[model samples]
Target: MKKDLNGKITRGTQRTLDAFFDAMTALLQTKPFADISVNELCERAGYPRATFYNYFEDRDDLLTYCWIALSQRADSADLASVESSRRVDVALDAMADLLESNTAMLHAVLAHNPPDGPLFASLHRFIEHNARQLMLTCVDRDRFDLPADLIADHYANTLLLVLDWAYLRGHTLTRAQLHDYVHTLLRGVE
Candidate 1:
């Protein structure tokens, strides 16, 4: 569902998108991403195959869109005015909340897709790409000694590592602790 000229997702489009997302999330809970099919998604979403194709190219495309949409919702904070050192803290808090809220789906998904699995690799790449873009926008280039791209990559890698530890490695830290640890780790970088 593409946005209109106002760049807002219309209610109808949002409903359609949410249905697909819910279907994808539910499917991921029961099986590996590879096992999911476009027809199955359409069946679960209560939409026709043509309707599914209207919004996405394939199941993989739907999966990617799911993460992108979820992350965009998580990143709703207006960080332009936030202090550079504190922005990541806020962002991590949002992400941690997102993870916590989707615990059931995540637990199920993680069970089938370990750190070395394709699903994890796909998510990692997606987050890294978005995180790098975010870092460039939020951080002041003059403050970092490293090149902007390098700094962005460093931050993205660090965020991914912390996320892996928090979620994929037995949940040693609570969501709050995860947020705090990431906040501390990123504080000195700015």
Candidate 2:
């Protein structure tokens, strides 16, 4: 009934969900999330309205799922391999690569004018969790100058801000430049 970490949706359920996402992605390009209707989603997905209900309670649930899916991919080894200190640059490069690879899809999602709450929350949680874990692994807890919780929170917020800036600015900086900027930003944190 539920998808695995690998994103393997059960056959019947997967098809419906896949269609739903496809439709949502398509519709998002033309309208805001609030403007998209379940009926319209069903129509785009080529499934009946009942089919949409069978998978998701509503559009919000689908949006949450999409965020979770993207977070998972972002946190995977390919993207996560960069050390915490370098995560900013790594994130920038990865995002740029993704945007370039799927410009249309990214544009569609961003154009949708989706509510920022769920997306922000999802990213905040993911970055906080990873930053905390990375700090624990790399630094001696007793020697650490800052509270673990505080450090994690700070890093998470910084990452989010940097990402938002980059996204809004259309990623003008090169990957190396972005990496240097992140290092400078982190170094300044006392």
Candidate 3:
């Protein structure tokens, strides 16, 4: 969402954006991402095509916006200020809670988007990027022989791989199990 001169989205603009987000989410439950069209989104939102263009370039852009908005809502904590050793636990807890709350949406997306599909790939990349960012900030490179980037990427890959298996592949593990698995796996690294 574009901000005004003060770098803040106006209440009205935020409302409009939320309309589109809600529309996209509602559509996703029944329609595949690829099958959804701009017209459909606008109609669902009761907005015109011109109005959508004012905030987004296309459906793909809107999808990105939706994920980002969802992620932001999930990440309500200041993880950056958290103790390094606890950051992963806290981050995973937040994400697990988010996924648990949005299981229906997740299942809908997974049903349409195969592991190698564009939508899945986009989500995977976004998650990996987030994991890498957090790892880079929280990791103490001096504690490991590997370079920081490699360590960060490793941590991110581990996170993404585990999450994909647990949630994306229809597995039914509880959040507590996920935390235990990740903690046990990362004990050496931590």
Candidate 4:
């Protein structure tokens, strides 16, 4: 009986979080983050004001959570397989797909009057972690004299730069085109 009650509570919490994310995504598309208020978010989420506070400290906190969730979704889609030469291709495709799927939300966030610092930081961390993992997998330590940490850092920065450029340029490249571009950029950098 107690376990059943706990499960119900957990399910309700998950539903609330889902509602919050959906509402926030919609709100971000329509207005800058600064203009969005707790009341608006609560109303859009169809949850009480108190329920919003129970889950998040404020709008920024909720935005950070949303960013993290996006990262996790990307990571899971891109990195669930074993590392190989094909990993880069998989990741590039996943990134392009993410951009395509979240076009409106991304456009809103990217074009926000004032950039969201926490969201950018979260995205940076996600890219860095994945880039480091890819570097460690693809670079041969014995053949290349570069330090692993340096290689990781370089790849991470390069990956973020590529992503920023694509976003700023409005994702002009198709998925296949971006895949080829990434492969070309990363080919001999061991």
Candidate 5:
């Protein structure tokens, strides 16, 4: 949603955005994005194809927007505030919560195609960015054998794999289990 002179989203625009994401989420559950046509999306959302184009550059743009709508960035834990031992937990749990909350979207976006698509890369960057931020804020760099960036990448990629597994498992996994697994992975799982 773009801001006007006042930089605020009108309720009408907000509702349209909501309908678009909701429609995408529902469609993602049934088919791969490659197979879903724009017409299908517009039909599901009860919007005209012209309206879809007006709001999104293309299907990929719509997919990216759907993910953003699912998760917000500012919710990242203040590493300066959370305990060091718990800082990792806080960040990982917040991510796990986001995964659980957006299970269908995550699945749709990360479907077993190549992991090299623009949107997939964007998803990777999103995870790595959050991991890198938390690692820099909470880690004692002097204690690590590798660079923080490397460590964060390891953690982020592993977490993505775990999230994919959880999604495939029908989300039967508990959040507590997710916490333990990611903690081990974050610690480099030696």
Candidate 6:
């Protein structure tokens, strides 16, 4: 949604933005994010191509927005309210399920990108940042003397790689199974 001159989201922009989100999600179900174009998105949303520009700088930007929105919605599910290693495992199980639930969209968002692409970087940064925030609340002393950022980065990268590995292996791992593996591995930290 584009902001008005005053920089507030305009009254009608939310409607168009919702339409764009729905259209983009629909396209993501059938094609990779790279294959979806502004022309197709605009036609599907029944909005003009210029209208897409009024909001997003490009398709990548729109896809990033979608991913961010997914994380935001997942956040409201109370992942952070959990504590203790036991509850952490439960929280992770829920998180894994949430991520996997968006299977088609997640695959489309990740599959076409190189390791250094914006989407990968965005997800990496997002996971590391969120891990830092979670450590602030959930970790007492972080169990090691390393810089907090470094530990968080490593853990975040591990989580991401494990998830990627699971998907690469045809998703043979159940959500609970994945969560248990990650939790068991990280329990060594304490």
- The C-alpha lDDT values of all candidates are 0.78, 0.61, 0.80, 0.68, 0.69, 0.65
Which number leads on TM-score?
3
What are the C-alpha RMSDs, in order, of all predicted structures? Answer: 2.6, 4.1, 2.3, 5.0, 4.4, 4.1
TM-score of each: 0.86, 0.72, 0.88, 0.72, 0.71, 0.72
After TM-score superposition, the amount by which residue 176's alpha carbon in candidate 1 deviates from its true location, in angstroms, is 6.1
- Per-residue CA lDDT of candidate 2, range 1-190, in tens? 2344366556787677677877877887788677889889988989998777766777877776665555555523443455555554555555545445666666566655542644445444665565455443443235457776666566555655565556543666666665666666777563
Over 1-190, each residue of candidate 5 has an lDDT whose tens digit, in order, gives 2223135777888788889888887876666667778999999999999888878888877877776665673367777688766766677677777776666656665564335655456666666666676666666566678776776666666767666556544556777877777767666433
What is the C-alpha lDDT profile of model 4 across 1-190, one tens digit per residue? 1112233457777788789888988887777667899999999999999998888888877876676556556634434354555655666666556666787777787666333354556566666776677655665456558786776676566666676667645557666666666667766773
Q: Which stretches of model 6 miss by more than 4 angstroms?
A: 1-11, 75-81, 104-137
Query: Residue 64 deviation, candidate 3, in Å?
Result: 0.8
Candidate 5 achieves a global lDDT of 0.69
Point out the higher-scoring one by TM-score: 1 or 2. 1
Give the worst 10-residue stretch by lDDT in candidate 6. Answer: 1-10
lDDT for position 83 in model 2? 54
Clashing pairs in 6: none
Worst 10 residues of 1 by lDDT: 1-10
lDDT tens readout by residue for model 3, 1-190 = 4323246777888898899999998887786778999999999999999999988878888888888888877854676688777777787877777777898878876676676787888888888898788778777767889888888887777777777889888777877788788877776667
lDDT of 2 at 84: 51
Greater lDDT among 3 and 6 belongs to 3
Model 6 residue-pair collision total: 0
lDDT leader: 3
TM-score (C-alpha, index-matched) for candidate 6? 0.72
Models sorted by TM-score, best on top: 3, 1, 4, 2, 6, 5
Off by over 4 Å in 2: 1-8, 78-96, 112-143, 169-171
Q: Give one digit per residue, the lDDT tens place, for model 6 in 17-94.
A: 777888988886676566788999999989999899988888877766666556656633344466545545554554
The ten-residue window of minimal lDDT in model 4 covers 1-10
Best-to-worst ranking by lDDT: 3, 1, 5, 4, 6, 2
TM-score of 3: 0.88
